[model samples]
Target: MKFMMTFHWVPDTEQRAEAIERFLRTGGVPPQGVQLLGRWTSADLGSGFDLLETDDAAKLTEFAYQWSDLMELEIMPVLEDAELAAVFGRVAKK
Candidate 1:
């Protein structure tokens, strides 16, 4: 039960940053089994990329909700190598 968490801001930079910072400090999200992966933010500088590993859907859902309430956010699954290969199948012959 892996979950990917994304953040999309629906407010001004200052407000957004404040929310994010607060989340980081008190979100209750587990620090173990999570990776930062990669991130990109050209505006507001209030964005991050996180790779989360959890087997409990309930916990993951709570984590997502916490982020959503903090800032306008979006999250989606990022499959692992095996999962990605299974979904995409073999590469086309060239």
Candidate 2:
């Protein structure tokens, strides 16, 4: 399954500095079982998005916990356009 994670951080300078330091130290690596497909950051560096794929939901929770202290994260399961189309196709045939 694929997950789209959006993260937002506060305007506190101290918190932002700590988050940056942690990211620099860890490279924002995901845990085992979760593969990071891509990531994008806002121009103001206050928010970002991450696309990840994983089979185990627990790993997703763990991955989120790793950064939970620094930012608020919203994780949602997502599907590709073709995948959604195939689901609709099957439903239409039924």
Candidate 3:
């Protein structure tokens, strides 16, 4: 399954700096079970989005926990456009 992980950093300079430093040191890689598709950050560096694919939701949770202290995280399951269209097609056929 694919998931969208959105994050908003805490409104604190020190925390943001620390998170950034850590990211630089660690390369901001996702956990073992999660495959990162793409990552985007807001122009102001306030919030960001990540597209990831994983069969194990627990890996996402673990990844969130790692950064939960410095930022708020929202993990949401997502489907590709074609996948959603297929669902709609089935409904229309019914």
Candidate 4:
């Protein structure tokens, strides 16, 4: 199954950037086939996210935990469309 990864912090851009950079610096790579859609630090800094794509739930969760270990990510939620008639298409799954 595919998962949507999101993180909410207490609101700090400089720290957020630093953390993300630090993560990459430490060679933190997500699961295979995961695609980074985009990332944003809220104007209020209440939260932010690096939009990503990953079909491997296990690997994705593993990587996500690493981030939480390094940085205190507030919230992480996964979602999916239950409708069989989704307009776009089905999320390719194994």
Tens digit of lDDT per residue, candidate 2, span 1-94? Answer: 9999999998989989999999999999999899999999999999999999999999999999998988999999999999999999989766
Across 2-93, the per-residue lDDT of candidate 1 in tens digits comes to 45666666657677777768867875454444534545554755565456676666666666675666566566767888887776676635
What's each prediction's clash count? 1, 0, 0, 1
- Judged by TM-score relative to the true structure, which candidate is superior, 1 or 3? 3
lDDT for each of the candidates?
A: 0.62, 0.95, 0.92, 0.61
Q: After superposition, how far is residue 8 of candidate 1 from its true place, in Å?
A: 1.1
In the range 1-94, model 3's lDDT, one tens digit per residue, is 9999999997899999999998999878889999999999999999999999999988888888888999999999999999999989989766
Candidate with maximal TM-score:
2
Superposed by TM-score, candidate 4 places the C-alpha of residue 78 at a distance from the truth, in angstroms, of 7.0
Could you tell me every candidate's TM-score relative to the true structure?
A: 0.58, 0.95, 0.94, 0.52
Q: How many backbone clashes does candidate 4 have?
A: 1
Segments of candidate 2 deviating more than 4 angstroms: none
Candidate 1: segments with Cα more than 4 A from true spot: 20-24, 31-43, 86-94
Best candidate, lDDT: 2
RMSD of each: 4.2, 1.4, 1.2, 6.8
Full candidate order by lDDT, most accurate first: 2, 3, 1, 4
Measured with C-alpha atoms, the lDDT of residue 63 in candidate 3 is 86
Lowest lDDT sum, 10 consecutive residues, model 1, at 28-37
